[model samples]
Target: MRAETGTRARRPAGPGLISKVGIILVGIVFFFPFIWMFASSLKPSLEVFSSGGSLLGSRLEWSNYSSVWTAVPFARILVNSFLVAAAGALLAVTVSLLSAYAFSRLQFRYRDRLFLVFLGTLVLPQEVLVIPLYIMASRAQMVDTYAALILPFAFGAFGAFMLRQFLLTLPRDYEEAARIDGAGQLRILVHVIAPLLRAPLAVVGAFLFIEYWNSFLWPLIVINDQDMATLPLGLQMFSGERGTDWGPLMAAATLAVVPSLLIVVAMQKQLANGVNLGGFGGR
Candidate 1:
């Protein structure tokens, strides 16, 4: 009887062990690049090249971070990134919310068709729009300006669509009740609907912020002045005149990733809840 009990206890352990192994393998796969980047950033330039063959290496040289910082206007680039991302996110969320509310709740002719056209823009990649956008920016003499970066991303179809879907899921009774209380549409939007939309708004804002923050191609194309360049563009400078400086480059790259990582970590709960709400509500 004791032997049978021991056998039963050990039976479940096999699957548990396998599951743990699978999880560890998956973790290693995902964590390997970050580990490599961090490790490379801590190595001296020569050590970085020498240790290239192994995933784990001997010594750590921490001066790469200071070298990278002094080599570029990293602080200014960081500020520019934050400003562009924050402005774009704020404008995108505000415009999208208002537009979505109108499209979802207001009665109008061709509303659905208009929204469908807006939704169609989602399938169009930003690469397709870059040339024309660049020409327009040049014509307006806005190249290398914050307006060039912030204004273009201020309105996004995805934000509008996501917000519209979320607004649709909300009970109309609240709006109706507010209306009966002599609250104007703007008042109701501000005092009622906006508060309820905190989760979805955070999700949309977070997404847009990350997009603008990490945007490389557009900034690389339009920003000619070093002072106007954002973090991604500035970080590209580390690739160098002769060959890539992997240690300082990785250090700069790691620093560039910090803000977005903090943003995600800080808003993770709101982001998750918003996504879930938007998903279930859409269906």
Candidate 2:
């Protein structure tokens, strides 16, 4: 017993030197692609994909960013992307929160059947629906407009289902208590439920933002004007029948990656907390 206690007392304290080195190596492994991307963006176009087999080249090309700006409507594309992604995420989260609250809390006729019907929409692929969506947009004269890009994708069945499941994990005590205090449903939802949902909702918003930001096909089919193009659509300018512009393309890609990266970093704490707090649960 004394020997075991002595051994326990003598145990090494913090992470040793080798452990720190191992952590650094692991970090490097994970971040090497990002580092290579930034490095490649700085290289000259010719050196970007050269057989020299190095992450960097002899000459750095500061002009790539300038070239990219002049070569395409990068500013407009960035704005369109920012607007579409931000608005789409906001609208989707709003729809999700409201519908999920209703489905989880309220007593309504055919609620279960209607929810099942709503969930059924998830099985339908976007590709299959785009043709119909396009025809509808044509009828509404919404094609080639921001509404065409943002509105169609704003309300997602997946978001509703996800939020509903998360709501199910929460206890009903607070909601009931609020109801007993002469508060209406909206008041309870806003004051009681929304506070507990901050972490999970942030996580959902981050994911929806990323999804909308990186979207390609729908926007491609919807918008024909160059000025209305998102970053993904703007990528076509970098490629041609003859060849591709590697340096500027890399720079543009790096810029496109930054917003999503910032969103993830900003919401990382909420993401972790939400995941710990039964992020996934449903009856």
Candidate 3:
């Protein structure tokens, strides 16, 4: 009995050596591309690939970063991306909150079927909808405008579906109690439900912001003027008949990653909780 107890006590408390090594390997695998981008940003255009995957170049080429600003209307591009992403995220979150409340809390006829139909829209790819969206935007005279960038995709069903799933998992007692106190639907959603949904809302908002920030194809199809181009479109300026300015392109990319990276890092905890409780795990 003593020997058995001692053996059990001697077992490792945390992940074993192999698990730790595997985790480290996986982290490195994911982080290596970012490292390569930053490293290549500091390299000469010619030396970017000629170094045979080595991170360091002959000398640190800080001018690549400077060249990025001069090579394109980068400032305007960054501003446009930030505005479009921020607005799109806010609009998406608001719409999701209202729609989720309606589907989950306030029921009418065939609500479940209606919700399932709305949810089914998620299966449709953006590429499939782009053509019709472009036609509508053209008809509305919104082409090359910020509205064209933001409005077309802001009403996606993903956010509404995710929020509704979370609402379904939530107890209705609080809402009922609020209703008894004569709280209106909008007031209940804003004051009661919205507060409780901070984590999931943060997750949805961050996802939307990242989606808008990194959007390339839709923006490319809609935006015609160089002044209105977003960061992803602006990056293309580095490539032309002269071939690609790899160093400057990487520099711009590294800069472009900062905002999304900061958002993800800031909301990391919320993101984790949202995934765990937001019905994303088959809950």
Q: TM-score of each candidate?
A: 0.89, 0.90, 0.95
Of 2 and 3, which scores higher on lDDT? Answer: 3
Q: What is the lDDT of residue 277 in candidate 2?
A: 68
List the candidate numbers ranked by TM-score, top first.
Answer: 3, 2, 1
Q: Mind giving the per-residue lDDT tens digits that candidate 2 earns over 1-283? A: 9999988876754457668889999999999888988899999988887837698788788888888899899999999999999999999888889999988889999999999998898899899989999999999999889899888877778778877888888889998888889999889988998898998788788888999899999999989999999999998789988799999998998989999998888888998887676646656
Model 3, residue 253: distance off in Å is 0.6
Cα lDDT listed for each candidate = 0.88, 0.88, 0.92
Span of ten consecutive residues with least summed lDDT in model 2 = 9-18
Return the number of clashes found in candidate 2. Answer: 0
- Point out where model 1 deviates above 4 Å: 1-27, 56-58, 278-283
What is the Cα-based lDDT of residue 39 in candidate 1?
Answer: 80
Q: What lDDT does candidate 2 reach at residue 80?
A: 94
Rank by lDDT (best first): 3, 1, 2
> Which stretches in model 2 have alpha-carbon errors above 4 Å?
6-30
Using lDDT as the measure, which candidate wins? 3
Cα lDDT of model 1 by residue, 1-283, tens digit? 9999999989999999999999999999997888888888987777777865775457677788999879888888998999999998999999999999989989999999998998888898889989999999999999999999988868778888888888888888988999999999999999999999999999999989999998998998889999999988988898866988888898998888888889999999998899888533663
For candidate 3, give the lDDT.
0.92
RMSD of each: 3.2, 2.6, 1.5
